[model samples]
Target: MVATFGEVVYESSRAFADDEEEECEAQTGLSFEVEHTSVAKSLLEKGSPAAGLVFCAFVGKVAVGFGDGFVNNKSGFDLLAEVCMVGQGENVVDIYLNRPKKKVVAQLYYGAKDKNNPVIFALFNTHGVPRFLANEIVSKVTEFIEVSNRILIFHSDTLAYYQSDERCEGKVFYVASSKYSRANIPSTAVPLAPPNVIGGIGAGVLMHGEMMDKPALLLANYGENELVDSISLQPFAAIVKQGAPDPSSFSLSQIFKQLELTISQSLKSNVNPVAISNLYI
Candidate 1:
């Protein structure tokens, strides 16, 4: 039988667990419960010829574009696509009906809590999703999930940073001065890092050497007067620092290794799992 809109799917967070033991425990990370129930069907059935899907998992938001149609065997990528399209936009909806045989591109954002259990606003764009949809997904995500006062969305070529104010109902304002680059970085280089404030220190894949010659793991701040410090990196600084083996070279393995170390450190430090979910995987 085909699944319909508003049907809750119980997913095993075990697939996202750290080890065999954790997987065995089968912890429930985030429930794929349907939201925006009022317009799910119509949105799927008639919104647009081009379908865009959005969904949340443990506070993480993901969006994908697929061809319109009724979906069958909604497992793996298909299920993921459907979840992302729900309540995504007025132009796109009803991703499940007549689902496409394949997905176009999927954009993901990782959400996390700091040491104090406050939400961390961070978006990671693995796939090249459009800026408009990315913004829309993040906005809707904040509405459904508890979020921090600040927000940052990172893509290969662009970075969107925002600060929220309680006085303004947690509305976010974009930071136009933040700079980022992916030029000359290998497509294999995965950009993953804990989200830091717009003008603060953080670590991730940054351009090193002259003319953006190579992709090197570096520690740097986003804005002027911001120190390149490890205060934001905390427990993972020592290990991640090792990944940058001088500015003259780039190693895909080393980069991934550093990411793994960061994730392990995060788990050990009791960092919110949701925050580190997309960092390594």
Candidate 2:
């Protein structure tokens, strides 16, 4: 699936500070302050793992542009679209509906705990589904499955490019299978170190299990000159472990304080900065 994302990178602890900073700037209208903060004492410290974990939730509407739908293995036809949002918040929502003209979709939430959980989110087709009926399906999914906070757009991008429907294709179907792969890691297994995929920290997290057999550290997983979008990545474990100057002396509360302030301030000024999910996925 094709997914595009945007994010505002900021010091989570200074969210509110960023807000004040913006207000101060707007009031003064001074372009004097450097666009980027480089002071080590300030919360804008880069590459800090503890600084990265606070992804909060903000509500917004998604516009589903008209597009082709995908064919499914089931008796009925289905549509799929690829969408994603990489914001510095705990919750994100996906809005979907049969009729794009009439905005219809659901909200999904994510938090620090699931930082490393590979499953992004899941949703079912609810096109033509009544409001009450649609809600019931959503409720069931939330109750039974994790990542309920994530919004799932039914008939999304995956359906948009189905080759068979217009091509007189036959239906695709799913059958029960007792076969299992021995390589499958149990859900409880600790995630292996992240792989060094260029421009793919998120994807690396998503595919952690499969790539565990490989080295977890970027120095080992990636070659010297991999071309990733301007991310200055070091080894994953090293980064996480080296959160603060003194590895032995670290606190979650301190990190939270820094993140919360950063988000409020930066976002209040319409900056909408993105914070790294401190998740160790």
TM-score of each: 0.22, 0.19
In candidate 2, what are the lDDT values of residues 164-252, reduced to their tens digit?
A: 12321111110011121122212222212211221122222122222233211111111111111111111111222332112123332
lDDT of 1 by residue, 1-281 (tens): 11112111222110111232232234322222222333333222222211112112211112111322214322222333232321233322221111112222222221112122111222222122222233433444333332211213222211221111111111132111112211211222233342232111122122111113332222222221111112223322232212222212323345345544654665587653223312212
- Report lDDT per candidate: 0.25, 0.23
RMSD of each: 20.5, 24.0
Worst lDDT 10-window in candidate 1: 161-170
Q: What is the Å distance of residue 209 in model 2 from its true position?
A: 38
The all-Cα superposition gives candidate 2 an RMSD in Å to the true structure of 24.0
- The lDDT, on a scale of 0 to 1, for candidate 1 is 0.25
lDDT at residue 202 of model 2 (Cα atoms): 22
